[model samples]
Target chain A: MISYMLCLVLFSVGLYCILRKRNVIKIIIGIGIMEYAANLFFVLLGYRTHGRSPIYAIDQEIKSMVDPLTQSVVLTGIVLGLSVTLLLVAIAIRIYERYGTFDITKITKLKG
Target chain B: MEISFIAIPLASAFVVAMIANLDERIQDCIACLAALATLTLSLFAITVLSGAGSSGAIVYKVGGWVPPFGVSIVIDGLAAFMLVTVNLIALAALFYSTGYMKKYTDKWKFYALFLLLLAGINGVLVSGDVFNLYIFMEIAAIAAYALVAFGTTAEELEASFKYAVMGTVASCFIFLGIAFLYGYSSTLNMADMASVLASKGPSGALLLASVLFLMGFGLKAALAPFHAWLAYAHSSAPAPVSAMLSGVVIKVLGMYAIARIFFNVFGITPVISFMILTLAVLSMIVGSMLAFVQSDIKRMLAYSTVSQIGYVALGLGVGTPLAIFGALFHLFNHSLFKSLLFLNSGSIERVAGTRDMGKIAGILDKAPLTAYTGLVGALSICGVPPLGGFWSKFIIILACIQAGRPILALTAVVVSILTLAYYFKSYTPVLFGNVTTSKQIKAKSLFTMNAPMVALTVLVALAAFILIPVVGNVFMDGAVASLVRGISYTDVVFEALK
Candidate 1:
């Protein structure tokens, strides 16, 4: 229960950074943090009090195992996060080249 | 055959990326051919599904694994309907891009990303596993991010960055919802999850999951308060990209997912329905009101998209069979006219050298074809009678009244009129007034660019015929029936998997 609360706290922090940060890079990091928190929560959902690795062997008996599906899904989510982060960083670099600043407030060329 | 919807585009994207350097024109040929092929497949799927009846959904398990264990692709009435709408717009936009993208340096990269985006949209339409759907959504979303930034202009980059950040946050929320759902049901397959949710009944966890999903997908669909990213993202992208973004991306990624998950998987509760209704009404009023004042052509169209999507959401919120039918029909019609309008704007931007309506005038004399098509698209979107938009709006309002929501029905009517007013106010001066610009019009509306607009114009004009009893019974009724069946989707998909 405490771990879940901690996860929510981490997610809130990331959301705060995303909402409050001025630097494009900081916002990207914030996105990464939020994604990590979600991923952590997913892993926690599958955790047991003393669960062992989810593996199969013909020779050995398995008693308890953590849910492997959430782990695999989280791994996929991490890959997606990596791609999004890489793309965000790449775009940030291009933005810096054009605007010559990392501050998002100054990058306000597009408006209604 | 079901997998071919994803495989063909994926392969084509790969080919475009690899062989792009060999020849400049080859990428264009490949991308168009791939889009055409997918469009053909979607048409075939539609016919097959309609012929097979409502119980005839096809479930193709990945690697021959059954549900609750392996991923599956389910092609039902709704998927088939959405597939046709998505592929049709995709084909037109790819053709338009061939000409419009010549202004940019790297045409091949654009085709590559475009095909990748198509692959993602098709994948999202057909996937039966919730996690698989998320993966595909990410694929489409990432490709869209890159495409939005394709121009590398300052405005485009900033818009793309903002869109990317907001979109990613939405994805995180969606992922969190999925995690909660997986934990509750102990399954990732949508059908299995639906059955589990049904057996378990309503719980706090499920309620939380639904709210999270609403926030996430609502942001994606640009519903009401979550719509800030749309105007920037849709207006700043290249015109064809904007067309695809407005035409089908939001519908498939945002609206379709919402309908499938809320109505089918979760079984729409009264609370959810009420929440959706409130958002729909808010989006309808606010979006059109915002659109009325935009001077930029694409920006107005973008806001109009937000407004129009409200009608779709309203229909879904009403949750009557007729209302869902209206929503689906409007979804198809919007894709047609919206893509046409955006493509027409691209042509105007190319020839008139500006998207600012104040600076451009007398398009009817300058580019008669573009002007006429834009007029048709604008009129259709404004819900003019005998055009596609009118019938859908009529049905939605009628459904609202039938469902005993008189005030909501009244709002729909007034919003429809407001939609007409704004579309006319923005487009009339550009299409009909005297030539007023001092800039030299390039006058190079190429055949490739004009062809798609003409095709879409014809579609926009003729789409109303589908509302006839004979055609609607055959095509639209199937989709309506599937959604009306609601959580029975689980049984149908499970039976198909057998």
Candidate 2:
């Protein structure tokens, strides 16, 4: 229970970094942290004490096993997170090239 | 098969990308052909839905796996309606892109990305499970982010970055919300989860998920508070992309998902209704009131997208059968007219080589087809009589009144008038007067560009025919019935499995 709350705390910390930081790279890092938190939470949901790997054999009876479904979900989530982070970094690199700075406050090329 | 909707685009996207060394003409032709194929398949999906009759949803289980085991593709009336809207606009956008994309280098990349985006949208529409929906949504989002930055200019990059941040944040919340749902219900299948949730009744987990979804999907939809990114992103995207984004992307990603999950899965509650209503009203006022202030033609349309989405929400928030029907109708109409308008903007921009309304005055002399199409689009969006927008707004307003909400009805009328004012501000200045040529581009893409705009204009003008009882009854009844059935959606899914 406490670990679950800690995961969200990490999420909040990441959110804080995103909201407060001006550096483009830092914001990207913040997004990464938030994604990690969500993935951690999903993985945690499937955990069980003394649960074995979700393998079934014809010779042995299985009493309890960790939920493998969520592990797969988390795996997909991690891949998606990598893609998003890669895209963000690519865009960030472009921003630095165009604007010569990482400060989001300085990147005011677009406005109404 | 519904599988073809996702398969064709995915396969074509790879083909376009692999043949990068080939001629640009070939890439454009392949992309356009793929889009047409999807459009036909979408029509087939709709036809199948209608043939199955009201309350019929064809469930295509993947690999012959039974329901609640493997991912399924369910094409209910609502999914069919949404698919047709998506693929139709996708075809138009592909056609327009052939003309507009000639200026940009590596046009093949754009076609590949566009097809991938369409596949994501189609996948989202047909997916029966929540996780698959999320995956498809991310695919669409990534493609959209890349496309918005396709120009690679400073402003375009900045806009794409900003949009990515906002969109990613929204997606995270949605993911977190799905996590909560899975933890509570122990299933990812939407129908199965809904049944489990119904039997279990409401809990803290469910409530939390709902709030997270409202925030997440609301941002995706560009509803009131979360609409800031839309103006920058939509305006910065290439013209046809702007059309695609405003026309069907928001509807499919945000509005369709919300309606399906909340109305069909969670069973819309009074609280949810009230909250959505408040946001709808806010979006209406904010979107319309701010639209005319922009100098950029695409930006103005972008802001208007925010408001038009508000009108659709107004119907949805009301939660009456008539209102839902009106919402869906408005959704369909807005896709035609808004895409038409965006394509017109692209045409004007192509000819004048500028998007600022002040500089492009009286280009009607230069481009009569674009001007006239722009006028038709403007009239339709403004709810002019006999036009598509008018009928939907009229129906939504009437639905509000019948639901005993005169104030909401009045609000709809006021927003429509406000919508008219901003469009008037744009068209009168942008399309009229004898003005200079401004800055014209060297390349001429008249045939490829005007063809799609003209096609959309005709559709927009004839859109009222959708409301004719015979057609409307067949076209709209099942979609509405699906929503009105609420949580009974589970029954339909389970029944189809048999």
Candidate 3:
């Protein structure tokens, strides 16, 4: 429960960064932090107290095993998160080159 | 056959990347051929699906592992419908890009990202597991971010950055929701999860998961409150990308995901249905009202996307068989006309050298093909009678009335009129007024560009003419039955697996 609360706090902090920050790079960082928080929560979801790695052999007795599914999912999520982060950084760099500033407010060419 | 939907595009994307060093002519030929193949395969799938019984959903287990253990591809009425929409729009967008993308260098990279995005959308539509769905969503989302920043201009980059940030945050919420669901159900397969959820009544954790999903997918769908990034990212992208984004991406990524999760995995309740309807109403009102204020052609179309999606959401929210049919019908029709309209905008931008409506005038006398197509598209979108939009909107509102929600039905009527009003306002200045400006207007390209607009314009007209019989059996019945079946989905899956 405490761990879940910690995850929530981390998520809120990331949200604040995304909502309040004006710098494009900083907003990207906020997104990274949020994804990391979710990934952490996924890992925690599969954790067990003193649980062994989930593997099986013909002779081994089956006991408490940490869920293997969340680990695999988190691994995929991490990879995807990395790609998204890279794309964000690349876009931010290009934005800086074009607008001459990382500030989002200065880059207001598109509007309704 | 199932894998081909994904494999074909994935291979094409790789080939495009490899052949980026080649001459432009070869690149254009490869890109057009690949896109045509995808479109043909999707049409074939639709035929196969039309013959399938509601009880006959096909599941292709990856690596020959049974579902609930390994990943599987489940193709059903709904999946087939969405696949057809995505692929058709992709084909049209590719054709448009062939002409529109000449201005930008490195045509190969553009097609590569486009095909990659197509593969991702198909993968998401067919995946049976929750986690794999997220994976495919990421694939699509990531590709979309790159495509939005393809121009790498200040405005494009800024919009792309903002879109990426908002989209990533939404993805985080989705992942968190999935984690909660997995923790509770101990299964990742949607069918198996539904069974587990049924066995265990709705819990606080499940409620939390639902809320998380609503927020996350809501952001993706661009519901009224979460719609800030859509107008920016959509209008800022190049025309074909904008077409694909507004045409089918949001629908597949947002609405399809929401429908699959809500109606299949988690049974719909009145409260949840009401919440969806409220959001739908808000989107309809806000999107149309806001669109009335936009001068940029594509930007107006972007807001119209929001309004059209509202009709879909409202239909889904009603949760009646007829209502679901209305929603799905509107979804397909919107994809057709919206893509056509976006391509039309691209043509206008190409010919007149501007997207600003206030500055540019008299596109009709200048470019006859684009003007006519734009007129047809506008009529279809505004729910004008004898056009595709009218029938779908009529059915949806009728369904609302039949479902005893007259107020929502009334709101639907008013909003659609608002839709007509805004579309006409945008259309008149560009397509109808006198040609005073002496900008040299020429066709963008013959095979790659003009063909798509012509074909899609024909389809928009054909959809309107064929509304009665074609839509009756193919879309309306299928979508309605899918929604009507509801939680019985769990029973069917468990029985099939057993």
Score each candidate by Cα lDDT: 0.93, 0.91, 0.86
Fraction of the reference Cα-Cα interface contacts (below 8 Å) that each candidate reproduces: 0.91, 0.81, 0.96
- For residues B1-498, what per-residue lDDT tens digits would candidate 3 score against the true structure? 787778889899999889888887787778778777877876676666567443546678889888789888877778877887888888889877877898898888999999899989999998888999999899999999999989888778878887988898889989999999999999999988988899899899888898889888989999889999999999989999999999998998899999999998998988788888988999999999889999988889999889889999999999988898889989989999998988888888877888889766778777788788889999988877888889999999999999999999999999998888887777888877766646556544355678899999888887865457765576445555666787677666555454
The share of true interface contacts that also appear in candidate 3 amounts to 0.96
Per-candidate RMSD, Å: 1.0, 1.3, 1.7
Docking class of 2: high
Pairs with steric clashes in candidate 3? none
The candidate, 1 or 2, that scores higher on TM-score is 1
- Chain A vs. true chain A, TM-score per model, equals 0.95, 0.97, 0.94
Indicate the residue-level lDDT of B456 in model 3: 93
> DockQ of candidates 1 onward, in order?
0.94, 0.90, 0.88
Off by over 4 Å in 3: B52-54, B437-447, B494-498
Note the B-chain TM-score for every model. 0.99, 0.98, 0.96
Candidate order by decreasing lDDT: 1, 2, 3
Question: C-alpha displacement of B478 in model 3, angstroms?
Answer: 2.8
- List the pairs of residues colliding in candidate 1: none
The numbered model that scores best in TM-score is: 1
